[model samples]
Structures are given as C-alpha cells and as structure tokens.
Target chain A: MRILPRTAESGSYAALAGLAPKRRPSLTPYYFILPYLVFFVLFRLGPSLAGLGIAFTNWQAVGTPRFVGFANFEAMARDPRLGDAFQNTVFFVLLTVPTLIVLSLALALFLNQPRRGRAVGRVVVFMPYVIMSTVVGVLWTWILDKDFGLLNVYLNFFGIANVPWLVSESTAMYGIILTTVWWTVGYDMVLFLAGLQDIPHELYEAARIDGARAWGVFRFVTLPLLAPTTFLVLMLTIINSFQVFDQVYVMTSGGPGTATLTLVQYIYTTSFQFQKFGYGSAVALILFGILVIVAFFQIRGYRRGLKGVE
Target chain B: MSRTISRAAWYVLLAVVVALVLAPALWMLSTSIKPEREIITTQIRWIPQNFTVEHFQAIVQNYPMMQWLFNSLFTATAATLLVLVLDSMAGYAFARMEFRGRGLLFMIVLSMLFVPIQITVVPLFILFSRLGLTDTYWALILPVGANVTGVFLMRQFFLSIPGELEEAARVDGASAFRVFWSVVLPLARPALTAVAIITFLSTWNSFFWPLIVTRSDSVRTLPVGIAQFLSLRAGMVQGQMSIGQSMAGAVFAALPPIIIFVILQRYFIEGISRTGIKG
Candidate 1:
C-alpha cells in the first residue's frame, strides 16, 4: 500500500540540469520498448491482422491459400453446424450472464457484512476458481453424473429422479452452465465486493437516516452507485461467455448432438480439428463482431442509465 | 434476543455457502481415495469406505503426470518472468518518456484486449510450425510474452507513482536504463507482484494454446495432459482412464495451486481486485 502522490513535479530535475532545452531526442525510449514491441508485432498484432486476412482466403493445413472474397462468410450463412453453434452460444450466454450477476452480487453482499466468519466464507467461495478449468470440468462431470453423482444422490433424498446432465442433449448446456457458475461466480463476487467497498459509508447512513429499509437502501443507494461495476462485470461476463470453450471441450465436447456447441469450440474444431483454417478464421471474426456490437449497445445503454441516474 | 438469532442465522448461511462451493472438490478427493467398488455405488458417501492410495499410485506409475506437472510449472514460471521484464521496461517508457508514436503504440496494445485469442491462434500456429518451434516449450512460452494486460497494468502502475526518485537518479547522470533498473523497478514490486501472480495463474491454468501446440507428453502441460489423457474421453492413444484414476490425476494436478492459493490468498484477491477495478 505504498502511497503515490500525483502532484510531484515530474521532470524538474532534467530542467534544473539544463538538459531539457537542447537535449537530442534520445533513442532510449525505443530501446526500452523494442523488445516488447517485437513480441507484440510478431505474436499478437501481426497474428491478429493475419487472422483477419485469413478469413477471406481458402487457407488449410496442407494447401496453398487462395484469396476467396466473402466465400467463407457466404458458407457460414448455410452452415447448419455454425447455426447450432451460434444459437447454443447465445443460449449459454443468456443462461449464464444474469445468473452469474445476481448470484455473485448476492454472495458479495452476504460476505461483505461485518461478521466473524465472513473471511473464511470469502476464501471458501473463491476456492474453486483457483482450480484449473479442465479440472473443474472433470470434477463437475463426476459431481453431475447421472447415476451415482453426489448431486443425484442428494436429489433422490427428496424423491427427485436423477437427471442426465452431460449425456442428455436437453440438459447438456445446463450442465456446462452450472459448472461455469460454480467455477467463475467467485471471481465476479470478488469484483462486486471491491465495488461494494468503494461506495461511501455516509451514503448508506444518509439513506438510513431517511428511514429507508434494507431493500430500499440497496435498490436506491447501493444499486445506482454500483452501476459502473455492474456494467463492467456484465461486459466481461458476456465476452467470456461468448468465448466459453474449455469446460465444453472437456465436459461435453459440444456433444449429445451439438447441444453445447459454442463459438470458440466451433473455431477450435474448424481450424484445428477439421483443418479448415479459413472457415475457422471466418467464424472467429463473427465472434469478434458480436462482441464489438454487444459492447457498443451495452455502453450506449449504460450511458443512458447514467444520464437517468444524474 | 433478535440480534442473537440473526447472528446464528448468519453463520448458518455462511456454512451452507461454503459447503456448496467445496462439495465438488471434496468429492474429487473422496473419490480418488475410495476403492472402485465404493466409487460406483449409489449411496452418498462424504467419507470414503475402505480408503486406498492405489489409484494415486496407478496414475503415477502409468501416466506422465509428473512430467506434465513439471512442464506446466516451468513454462508458466518462464512466461511470468518474460512478461515482467518486457512489460516493465515498455511500461516505463510509456509512462515517463516522451517518445514518437507513444500514444498510438499503447493504443494498439490496448485495443488488442478486445481481440479474442481464438482469432490469432491459427496464424500463430502457422507461424510456429514454419519456425519449427511447434511442440516445444518455446511455443508454449513465447506467445504469452505478447499478453496485453500485464503491459497495461504495469503502465497504469508506473503512471501512479511519483517520478521524483527516477528523475533525481537521472539528474545524477545515471543512464535511463540504469535509472529504470535500479530506481524504478524496486518501487514497482507491488505492481510486479500483481502482474506475476495473474500471469502465472493464467499460464498454469491455460489450456487452449497449449492443447493446440504441444503434441507429446514431454512438453504437454497439466491442463492439456489431464484433459487429453486422464479425462472421461481420454484421447486416442491412452484409451479411457478409470474414474478412480481420473480423480487421482485431478487431485494431483489441483493440489499445488490450491495450496499456493490458500497461502497467498491475500495477494491473489488484491491482484484480482486491482485488475477488475482498473481494467
């Protein structure tokens, strides 16, 4: 918690040394940045631009790539598997985003209380997040097993029949969604807790002085003040949900008839599995488009919400 | 009396949440230690009956579990160190120096945040293949150096700290590199810790690129290896691993980080919170 004061005169020493006036433009900055810039261009920036170009070409693992303008995009229009991937992805996002937002916020609020064991509670809740994604998926697949899973065993105590979580097409996406919420909800909760701590104590006191009850205080003072965090969490959750692949790859492999097929899964299969690099790049671009468009509307709606609050 | 009741209820709620969160992990541990006959039973067993270490021994003897663990540790540590050096130097330049294309270069870096890694994976694979670097540790570690978040976090951190110390060192005729290394970097420990933890955790947990790039168990990481060899649908060559063995491998893969996390929980939470609020 080192304090960094903002008002310190930054470049005064150079001025005092008379080097500020006529010092040659130094290559020092470039030298410092060159190593990272090379990596950025080669690995990140270059690949990203090349991926865009790849979308319009007929690239494959073992063939010369030819420029085929809009062919891949046109093919995506008629691709039934792509349609399923897109729909299932949207369905997954719909199921996950609100559930995660509400659940994590609830957990955050509950843990934020001044209680004796809340620290332990916070640590326990965030524990699953520390496990690798594949491990979480593997572990949950066992927990959600149809016959002898812990979940089914508990359900049967209440006279409920066992549900085929990953094997059944109808419930496969739900299984991944359940695992995801358990795996990542803690992360969102941590973010929400940080947001909760940032709200001034006097705001709550003011609301209480006005005779507001708990729900009323939360709805007005807490919710409105937490708008930015909520927006950020929402945006991050959506982007992440759109890119959901690891759990699906391990748990379902987009199976039980592509019930859990998702955008990134499609990208992986198309490019890596099928070796249709061009088509995969096209699908990846569609994912990027969806994210940018969704972000645009979210920011717009968030701006409107801010204006309303003001 | 009402306050006492509320306090009791609060503990009850906390207990329930903790149980729900921990049950799956506990189940993995339980099943790993249980004999196969007990594991396949319909009864709910929190504690294993006739507990055994046979499954753990089987996985250790049969698979390259230990090798995958070593690869994951080595690659993630290397990636973290690489990111720290590259990002801190670049971040210093961005924050304190007047340079050509400084604004645009940083903007380019930041804008990549929105571009999904899936978009770049294919071309990157191609690049690696061309360079004959595929299926190596270099393939696993190099691309992570291009990560954007560490650079952004470092830059933000450098901007926050007062520049007087670095300026004074420079005034005393310490070269820019000397000033950055000796003066600035020592003060950057907090940001460095945050970045290091985040990068290490993510790399250790990373599955996608590693899954694509590494072909054999020698270079295969834990996540990829576990998914490929020990999963329910264990890959073509290994055949399907038994549930008991799968859980055993999982416990082996999961315990190290969980232990580290419990010890370093404060830094972990602080690092995540900082990234969340700022980024």
Candidate 2:
C-alpha cells in the first residue's frame, strides 16, 4: 500500500524540504496552520476539556454550577435508562457490524467481477448512502408502518401477518439495524472493491496455474490480501454503530418503553430535554471513554494484522 | 456457454440488489406524487395513479420547508468553503512545512479524531448560548467547519504531489501563499473537490447539532425541520400526518445530496477508498 512509506523518518524531511526555498527557514507554515488551530481549540479542544469538567459539576443552564464530585457518574450507574441505553447500544453494535462487513464484502466481490452493466449496479448500491440520515429514518419508518408499509404489504402478499416493526419493542431495534445496513453498506463495499483492485493479478495468475478453483482462489488469495481493508472497515463501522442516534431518534424516539434508546439519544434527552447538562456531560464522557477503548483495541488488532501480513 | 450463463445470472442478482436498495427512495417519490387517499391505501402501488403536486405546493406555501431548504444550502455552502480553506492550509503545513513543535501539534490534531465529537456538544451548546450565538446560523456553521478529517485527507493528498512543482515555483520568487495558490491548489483540485462534496453532504445532512442548538424554524436546517415536521404531524390527531407533504419535504431534503452524488460519484467512491488506504 502507499501508506507503507509513511512510517519512515525521511518522508517527513522530504515533505518539508519540498516546501523550502533556497534552504532558508520560513514562518509561512505556521501562518497556514494557525487559522485551523484557532477554531480547533475553541470548538474541539476547549469544549472537550469543558465537557470533562462539567461532568463533575451540577451545572444547569441558568444556575451557577456547584461541584458535585462523581454524583453524575453515580447517577449514570443507578439510572435504569442509562443501563438500557448501554445494553441497546452494545446490541446495536453486535447486530450491525458483523452483518455489515459480510454483506458489503459480498457485494464488493460480486461487483468486482468483470461484467456488463456493473457501473449502474455500483451507482445503485451507493445511492442510498448519500441521502441524509433523517430522511432515511423517516422514509424507513413509513415503509415499516404496519398498515400501509411496503414491507408489510409484501409480507401480506406472501400470506404472512402484519408486523409492527418500529412500534414493537422486539422489532424496533432490528428495523433500525436493517435501515442502517441499507444506508451504509455502499461505503464499505466501495472500500472493499478498492482493496480488491489493489491486489496484484499476478498472484491470481499463479493460483490459476496451480489449478486453484474459484472458491480456493478467493479463500487463499483474496481474503488474505484484503485483511487491512477489512480491519479499516470493521473499526469504522464499529465506532459509528456505537454512536447510533439520528435514525433511532427520528424513527422510534427511543420509544416503545426505551427499547431503542442508544447512549447518544440518552445523552441528548438528559442534556437538552431535561436540562441536566452535568449528567449529560458525564454520559458523554462515558461514551467517549468507551469509544477510545474500542478504538485502542482495534488499532492494536490492526498492528497485529500488519505484523502477520509482514 | 457456461460463462455466458453465469454472466446472465450475475445481471439478475444485481438487478434484485438494485431494486431492494432503491425501493425506499422510489417509494418516497411515489408517495410524494400520490393523492392523499391513494397514499393511505393498503395496496402497494409502485407508480401512483392519481399524481398531484398539491402536497409539494402545500408544504412550500404553508410550512417553512422552503426556509429550511435555503438555510441548509447557505450553511452547507459556507461550511464547505471554510473547511476547504482552513483544512487545506493546515494540511499544507503538516505535509510540507517544518515549524517548531510541528510534529507534536500534528499528533495532537490526529489524536483529536478519536475524541468522539458528540462529547463537545454539551459544552459547545453552553458556550454558544453564552455568546448568544445559539439559534443562529453561526452556531450551525462554525463547529462543523472545524472538522479535522479534512485536514488529514488534504495532508495525505499534498504528500502525494511531488515536491518539485512547489520548489520550482518557490525558486521563481513566488511567495509561499502565491505558490500554493497558483501551483499547488490547482493540482489539488481532486482532493479539494472530495473535501467539498463530503463537507457539503455532511453539513446539509447534519441533524444532531442543529436539532440541539436551533429552536426556531427561521434558522433550522432541512433535516431538523423535516424531523420536527414528522414528529409534529405524528403527534397530532390520529391519521392527521401529512404523508404527501412529509414525503415531499424528504424528497426536497434528499435531492441536493443525491444529485451531487450522481454527478460526482467517482470522487465520492475514490475519496472513501483513499481514506481507507490513508487510515
């Protein structure tokens, strides 16, 4: 991959040397970075630190904040809604990630083949991804409506009973999951297609000379070569799924007795609706902590995969 | 003969996949055109028999749907422009310049990626409210404009452009900014376009922050406005939800991004693949 050169020390010097004129020092670079850094600090870094601080204080919007010292964290621990939100988030992650990986990979492999009309197929598959999340949520909610829903209509045609997808607790999360997969699989598919394109055809030629069957070629050659892309897709999908909110908010509003209440939705309700900014910040930190830990493990696994590839 | 059969089968499978993926969008369009009575029918109609533009007219005339669309366009465009300038400058510095603490600062910026941007929302809301920026377009435009991923992407792209072009321009007595403007920026068109498309799509589609910050219809972006519309209609008397109007609103909200995707499909796909490689 092109990224292989990035780990070398000389790459940075090469890049820096490119920017220099007559081997003299220049301050223009700092000027370039300053504008972005200002906003970055004010909006990103400063707010992140403030969020951490606010998590410990009882700061409602109007009142002077008093230091509460882990009370919010304790509240998070005891709150059943938070627990439900946590479990639902985990359930959503588990439900979506593996399925997304497998399905997108399959689609990518299918489309990777040389065929007529593949361009149309690619565009068709990718179109849903560009639509806004709220639109996806609203459209899917209507399509899953028990009475007039297209899904129920199809089911009825097949002699099946009407299933209230978003209204029922058992089915609501799954509906959200299905909608998500439909919406996002195109991105991962495109990534996998790129990975497939990156693999040298010489290896496939060698396998063919050795009389390898199609399945054998895919299993032995394709899968091993695509490991890095798979890792990238897995990490991104996991991180994104853990923060699922918009669709859940629009579709179910974390409703039917909190069945689809994701951590993000929980945080929003706590901070915005209930005006418990401090407790909301605490939950947000918890979410941040969990994401960091998850990302850490994923990075560690990626390194291990790289070493194995080497 | 066997190869031909398999190719035919692939076409069939691909067709089924396309139909499944496009069904919801196609249904939304269909519903947007259908008359009110037809939309509530249990029968599945892929094509509306009684087509009418009343729903589209209704939303535009009565609701702030047009305002939401305009707000979405204005904010998304501003955010995209701001991101391109800021991220490209920062990316150039990281890619090409050596300043004091450059490496450390670069690492800090990269680490910001994992910070889970939602963590900033509570504090940002409070800060913006304090500044009296809440419920305004500035509140929607600024935070999103500060995204660091564009910086990373632009840096990656700048790295790929060989140093000789910039060096040549520099030796010709062009200032750093001048060289960047005339030489590097033109060459960086593909990357800039990618960043622009991504920023516009995200800003236009952004719901969570706008939903939190903006309380009035005057400043609400399309996604939030449409969501509020759905909730409001759903909450009213049973069966009062304006299906056609809501679908029309959704179609309006969806069209710009979808059209952009259709036009710039290559860049979209290329950009995603590039991010995977770079990440």
Candidate 3:
C-alpha cells in the first residue's frame, strides 16, 4: 500500500506548482542525473563515437591500433561476404515486415472485438515474445531439424516430403523468418491493439450508421485512424530486422553456407570471430547508415499520415 | 445468422492461432521431460512417450546450470534495482528540474535510443577489455544499466505528475530529495513496476553482449550457457542425454522471463504500448 501512493495528486500541474522560490541554482539537478549520465557517457556516447573512429582504423584487438583511412570501408565494398550479408539481412526484413504488418493488424482487429477468450488469446500470442531469443532459436532448431525435427516428422506423417527447413540454403532464410514472425508478431499486435483501442468508439458508430459493413468500417474508419501505429510498427520492424542476431546465431551460426548470415552476425564474426575489427566496424557503420535512412523516411511518413488523419 | 457464423469462425481461428503460438514452447517443454531415446524418434509425439525429469537432473548435475541461473538472476535483479534508482532520479531531473543544457542533455539521451547497441559492440568490448572488466558481472550490469530507455520511460511518466503536491511538500519544509523520495516515487509505482519488469526481462534475456564478453563458463548468463550447450550438441558429440539436456537448458533459461511475464502481464503490455516498440 505504501508503494502504491495516491497517483491522483501527482499530475503535471502539481509538478509545475511544486517549484517554490528558485533557491539559487544549486547543483541538485546535476547530482540527480550524474549517476545515469556517467554510465551513459562512458558506455553509450563514448562507444558510439569510438565505433566511428575505430571503423577508420585497423584495430584487431592487438598491438597499438594503426589508422587506415577508409581501407576498412574499401575492403567491405569489395567483400562478397559483406554483400551476401546485406542481401540476406534485407531479404529477412522483406520476408518478415509485410507479413508482420498484415497479420498483426488482422490479429488486433479480431481481438478488438468483444469475443470469448480474447484476453487469453492476447496472452498466448505474446508469450513467445517474452521468452529469450536463445531459447526460441534452440526450440525452433529442434523443431525444424531436417532429419529428426518435429516439423519434418509432422510433414512426413502428412505424406509430404521433408522440407529441409534450416538445412538447405533456400529454405534456411524462410525458417528464420517463420521463427521471427512467431516470436515477434505478438509485439506488433499489442501495439496495434493499443492503437485500435485508441480509436474513439463513436467513429465506428458513425460508420455503422452510414451502413458501412465490416470491410467498409475497417478500410474507411479503422485503417486511416491506425496509420500512425502502422507506420510506427513498420519502422520498428525494419530496425529490429536489420539488427537480428541472436536467433540467427543460435539456429544456424550463419549457416550451412552463410545463407542466413545477417548484417549483425557478419559484424560479429568479422570483428570477434575473425579478428577483423576495423572492417567489422565499417560494416556496422553501413548498417547504421541504412537504419538512419529508413528511420528518416518512416518518421516523415508518420508525420504526413498524422496530418492526413487530422 | 451470418454474424453468428462469423463469430464462431473467429473463435475457431483464435484457438488455432493460440495453439500455433504455444506449440513450439510446448514442444520444448515436452522434449525437456522426454527420455533421449524417444526425443528424436521417427514419429513426432506431442506427449512424451516416457516422461522424465532426468534430463533436467542430468544437465543440472553436469553443467554449471545453477551457476548460470544464479548469475542471470543476480545480474538482472541488480540491474533492475540500479536502473530504478538511477533512472527515476535522472527522469525526475529531466522532467521537473530546471537547469541549463537540460534540453540538450535530454535530447542526447533520447537520440541514443536510435543508435543500435550492436553498432557499439566492438568499441565497448575493447573498452571493457582495456579496463580489465571483461567477463565480470560489471561488464553486463554497467552497460545494460546505461541504456536510456528506462530513463525515457521514467521521464514520460514523471512528466504527468502535477507540481502542486511537491509545492505543498516544500511548503512543509521538505527538501527536494525528500519530496521526490516520499511524494513522487511512491505515486510513480506503476511506472516503476513497468520499468522494473522490462529491465529485468531484458537483462535476463540479453544474449549478444554476454556471448561476446564472457569467455568462461563461470560468468556466463543462462541464455549464453544454453546457446553454448546447443552449439556443443550441434557438433554431434553423440550422447543419448545431449538432446534432452539441451531442451532442458532452454526450458530453464526461458522459465524466469515467462513466469515474470505471466505475473506482470499488465505491466509488460503497458510497457510495450508506451514504448511503441519491442526489440
């Protein structure tokens, strides 16, 4: 009960009123934020700048680092593996994002209705999201194991041939995508659910009064109103897709042939596994560039979509 | 009549989706308890032919499962506590305290969110190694604590708090610390819980950094341990117990977060809705 203090009194208006006579600008604020700021400066701000600096050097976790301007970037541009890594990462994103958008929205739409077991359905869908990526990778690898995996076992039972889910280069990416969808679709669904709940009930009522049926109501009323959330989901999914590492690491280890090797996994191997720190940092910089550009456009779309809604 | 039929279809569809979502985890659980001989048999069995906790017992006995579990729990709990304290303070400062460069500082913190931590991995690893802190618990807790998401969450929550109560507290001769400690934080429990659940789950489930930093079996977290166990099995050492034990490791590694999610389901959902992203 002590922990649950009355929240009614702590509004912004109360906070504004709380400022008494401006006691001479003491270092109170600085003190309050110092602990967080220290760590942030050391870990985040410093590392980010250092990453940029290290990308221009040939620091291989040994001897005094020597600078090699753009050599790392130059080498990366010529590296076929880097190209494969980018291709696989984008392919993974393309496979996951659109399906996530359509499916999660559909789910949110269904769950928004007054249905029996709605809450349970929401919980069940989101369950995988909370589990560790490592666990998901392990479980799915077992399930999708080519010879003795459960999935093949089931397929064989259905009189279909084994699909070689994570084994074949062609199917490996799809296997990762399927696992990615099952693992993360719930997150996008929850966001959409929130967006769905935010749309005023009266908007739907107005559509109903206009004799709009289910599809009409959704297309005309719900979809337009949910644009902001949709845009946000798209942006987030793209960022997450680009940064995918854990599941790929555990499931395939960049694979039977570098089939599932993603940008992050590539950076991991190049830097840590192969001791190519400078080149890896350059690859990371490329990833950072891609993410920034995607975020820029998505944010612009978000604003434009919002204005249209208004 | 059509509406009724559609409703029935929706219910059926939901049942199917739920089963699909639950199946893999359920399969993991089933595999964890099944004897090794039956696990990879020709036929798929949802129910283990022979149910046994022997795999769990074997892994726990053979590997440092308890050590990894304890490392995860200890680090996650410590990180959560530290985050609550540091983030609440920083959040209060950003939201309420008037200071020079405050906007600039807060913007710097906010922008950090967009910079993927993976981008910083090499530098951070080098930095930690130089400081001789690699493979230590501080290696995980410190950087993870440094993340600005919790600070942002706290700031947004604290922004909604009105100034009136704090003014009254000041009128009663309470200091700024006292006001925040006694008046603000208690009322901020919902936000605190949301941040705590998120921080704990993230720290516990985090894999990438721990994987790179901890080169030894002694300091690795549960996820790292489970992943290593898996890779070892993937090397095909040919033990009857390997597959089941690997499944058991996964089950144990996933247990804390799952239990935490079930208990703090509302807060977890709330945190997601607030952030508008989950990564």
Candidate 4:
C-alpha cells in the first residue's frame, strides 16, 4: 500500500542550494541513461517498429519483401487454421484465468491462517513453479500417459476408468490446462498471500468484535480490501493464458488434430517453420490487439468497481 | 474441542494439497531412477524396484546435456549482470535527476511493457541473422538488456530510499559517478538481487527465442534442448530416447533451479511478491 514519493523536485532543490555538488544543466544524468537506452533502442524499440512495418509486407525468409498492405490480415479471415488457433486461444484463456484465480485464492486463504506448518505448505506448493516449463511439459506427458500414467493408476483406485489425456483430441487441451494450473497456481497464491498480509489486522479485529461470523468477515472485510490484488492477479493470469505456448508445444505440438493449436504456436510454425514472416507477424499483431483490448476493459471495470466502492 | 478438530482438518487439507503438488515432481524423480522394465509396467509403483543410474549415464553420453546446461548458466548469468548494471544507472537517473524530456522518455520505456515480445521476434530474428550473430551467446545475452521490468523495479526501489546519503557524498564534491558507485549501489542490493533472480530465472527457462536462433546444440540452452530432444513427442518420433532417459533429462534440467529455490526460498518468494505488489 506504500506510494512512491516524488523526489525530482527535492533533488533539484538540493542542487540549487549547493547542498548537492552537481552543477545545473549538467549532462551526467544523460550519461547514466544512455548506455541502457542504446540497447533498448536497438533490441526492443527498433525491432517493435520494424515488426509493425513487416506486418504489411509480403516478406519471406529468402525474398525481398514487397509491400502488400492488408493482404495478410485478409488472409486470416479465410484461414481456418488461424480461426481455430484464435478460438482455441480464447478457450484456453477462459478455462485457465477463472480457475487459476479461484484455486489460487483458496490456497492463499487457507495458507494465510495463523497455524503451524503453513510455511512448509507454501514452500511445497510453490516448488513446481521453479521447474522449467519444458521439463514440466515432459514430466506431465509421462504422468498423463494412457497405460501406465500415475494419474490413471490413481484414478482406478477410485473406480474411475483411464482417461486418454494428451493423446485424445477431446482431452488434450484439458491435460495441458491441468499441467499449467498445477505449475502456476502457487505463484498466484503467493501474490494473493502478499495482498492478504497487507490488509490491516485491526479491520478483522473490528469485524469479529461486531459479532461477525467467519463467512461474514471474509465476505465483507476481506473481499473488498483485496480488490486491487484480485484485479492484478486476474490481469496477469489472463495475459499469461492468452500466450500459452510452451506446454502445448512440448506436450502435444498442438496435435492429435489441431485441438491445442494456439495463436503463438501458429505464429511459430508459420514464420519460423514455414518461413512466412509476414503472415506470422500479422497474427502476432492480432494477438497484440487482443491483449490491448482485454487490458483496456479490465482497467475500465476495475475503475468502475473502485467508484462503486467509494 | 471444535478448535482442535478444525486444526486437525487443516493438517489433512495441507497434506492433500502438498501431495497433489509434489506428486508429478516426485514421479519424475522416481521415473528417472527406475529401470526401463519397471518404468513400462502398468502397476503403480511409487518406489522403484530396481534403482539404476544407467538412464542418466546414457543421456550424458549421447546428448549434449552438459553443454546445454553450461549454455543456460552462462547466458543467464551474463544477462543478469548486464541488466543489473544498466538498470541501476538508468534507475538512479530517473529517480533523482531532473532533465528535459525525462518524463516522456521514462514513459516511452514503460510503454514497452504492454508490447509483448512476440511482436518483436520476427524482426529480431532477421536482424540477428543479418548480423550473423545467430547461434551465438550474444544472440541470447544482448536482447535481455532491453528488459522493461528491471528498470521499473529499480526506479521504484531508488525512489523509496531516502537520498540523504547520495546528497552527503555529493556535497563532499564527489562526482555524480563517484556518488553512485560508492554511496548508492551498495544500498541497492535488495533491489538488485530481486531483479537478478527474476532475470536469471526467465532467461534460464527461456525457450522460444533460443529455439529460433540456435541451430545446433552448441548454443541451445537447457529448455530448448529439452523441448527439442527430451520431450515425449520427440522421444516417440525418434524412437531413440526411452521414457526413463527422458525423465532423466528432465530431472537433469530441473534440479538445479529447484535446489536453488529451496536454498534461497525466502529471497525467491519475497522477490516474486515484490514484483506483483509493485507492478
């Protein structure tokens, strides 16, 4: 809840009074910034601009690019694969964002209790996130294997039949989603725990003194105060889900029949694998557009919720 | 009595949660050590009947596992060091100095956060290829210097700290560079450590760019190498790497970071929580 204090004015004042020895109109600040600026321009800013321009061209790996305005974007309208990729990506986001929010919130609330051994639980839960994504993908594939997978073996104990997880078109996305949730829910829980800890304990004490029950305290006191963190977690999860690629690439290669084909996977295959740079860039731009629109709505909703709270 | 019951229930819930989270990792480790015959069996075996190091030995002998590991370590460390130096200086300037167009410049840098890296990859690839820098460490190390998060976090941290020490050093006629070097950099350790850990972790786990740029095993990092060769699909198609060996490769790639996380558990949690709260 701490706000960053404005220091620029105070810094100038110190220099004016000669309390700081820096002379006015000095170029030292520029000197400090220039080194990072060089790399930022070449690697980050310049490439972003170039990518935008390339989206309009008929660029390929071996040919001189010719300007072909809006052709690639139009191609997307007829490309069934791109359509499938878009739909699959949205479905992925829908499946993941809400589930991750609720599950991680539950875990945070459970672990935030003033009980013994909670730290161990927190550590254990966050352990998987430390593993590399590709390793996670490989490990989960074996665990979700049909005949001898650990998941099916345990399910049989509960009288459940074996579920063809990654090998079946109907169940492949679900398998990746399960792996993703397991790998990342702990991260969101950690964020939510930080938020919970930020709430003043006095509010809870007051709620209990007013004869509020546990559910009442949580609903009334906890939820309202936790809005900012919830908004942040939601945004982070949504953005990450929209860009889901690593596990899909490693686990199924968007396969069994394009069931797990995501936008980034499509982009990777088109540009890198097939050397259609322009089309890939166009798809990547569309992805950027989707992220921007989602972020816009999320921020607007958050502002409206804040106004309602006020 | 109800309090005691609730406490016992908490323990049970904790146990279940822990088991669910740890099972896959434990399964990976178990599979890595199990012999091929036991790994292929249908019966559920948490403990291997016969523990073997043959899979690990085979992967090491056949694949460039150690080279991939070294590549990951070298690039991630170089990137982290680069980000720390560059971000701290730029962060110091942004926090404490007043200059023309400073606010606008800072805004431009911050705007990159919304611009995902996917947009830049195509052009970045072309640029690197033109420079003939693909399949080199510079291809991996240089782009990381342009990261936005480290700069933002560093600037926030610098703003939060009181500027009295820097001022005192400056009033003693220390130059701007001297004040920053001796007076400010030491105080920025916590922020530096957080930025370093985040950058290192991401770079080490980075798959996409390395996959694009590197053609051979000489420059492929651990994640890319694992995804290309050790994945289940890869194993299935190539018919070379067994499940046990695949698991061994996975465990080989995973253990260092996991072990580091356990050792620096506090810093890892604190650093991650810091990013969330501050962002």
Clashing residue pairs, backbone N/CA/C < 3 A, model 2: none
Model 4 residue B138 CA deviation (Å) reads 0.4
Going through the candidates in order, state the TM-score of chain A alone for each one: 0.93, 0.91, 0.91, 0.94
C-alpha lDDT (0 to 100) for residue A286 of candidate 1: 94
Model 4 alpha-carbon miss at residue B278, Å: 3.3
DockQ of each: 0.54, 0.54, 0.49, 0.59
Give the per-residue lDDT digits (tens) of candidate 1, residues A1-310: 1211111232344455565543455677888899999999999999999999999999987879999999999999999999999999999999999999999999999999999999999999998888999998888888888887888889999999988888889988899999999999999999899999999999999999999999999999999999988998999999999999999999888998889889899999999999999999999999999998999999999999999889
Write the residue-wise lDDT of candidate 3 on B1-279 in tens digits. Answer: 999999889889989988888988998898889887887687777887678999888888888989999998999999999899999999988887766788999999888778887679888998899899999999989997687889988888888767778767766878779989998999899788878877887898899899999978778998898887754223243344477888888898888788878887888888788776322
Q: Report the Cα lDDT for candidate 3.
A: 0.84
Better of 2 and 3 by lDDT: 2
Q: Which window of ten consecutive residues has the lowest lDDT sum in model 4 chain B? A: B230-239
Off by over 4 Å in 4: A1-24, B234-237
The C-alpha lDDT values of all candidates are 0.89, 0.85, 0.84, 0.89
TM-scores for candidates 1 onward, in order: 0.95, 0.94, 0.93, 0.96
* Model 2 Cα lDDT, one tens digit per residue, B98-170: 6678789889888888777677898898889889999999999999757888999999898888877776766
lDDT of model 2 at position B98: 60
How many collisions per candidate? 0, 0, 15, 0
Superposed Cα deviation of residue A298, candidate 2 (Å)? 1.0
lDDT of 2 at A8: 35
Better of 2 and 4 by DockQ: 4
Candidate maximizing DockQ: 4
Per-residue lDDT over A58-87 for candidate 4, one digit per residue giving the tens place of the 0 to 100 score: 899887999999999999999999998999
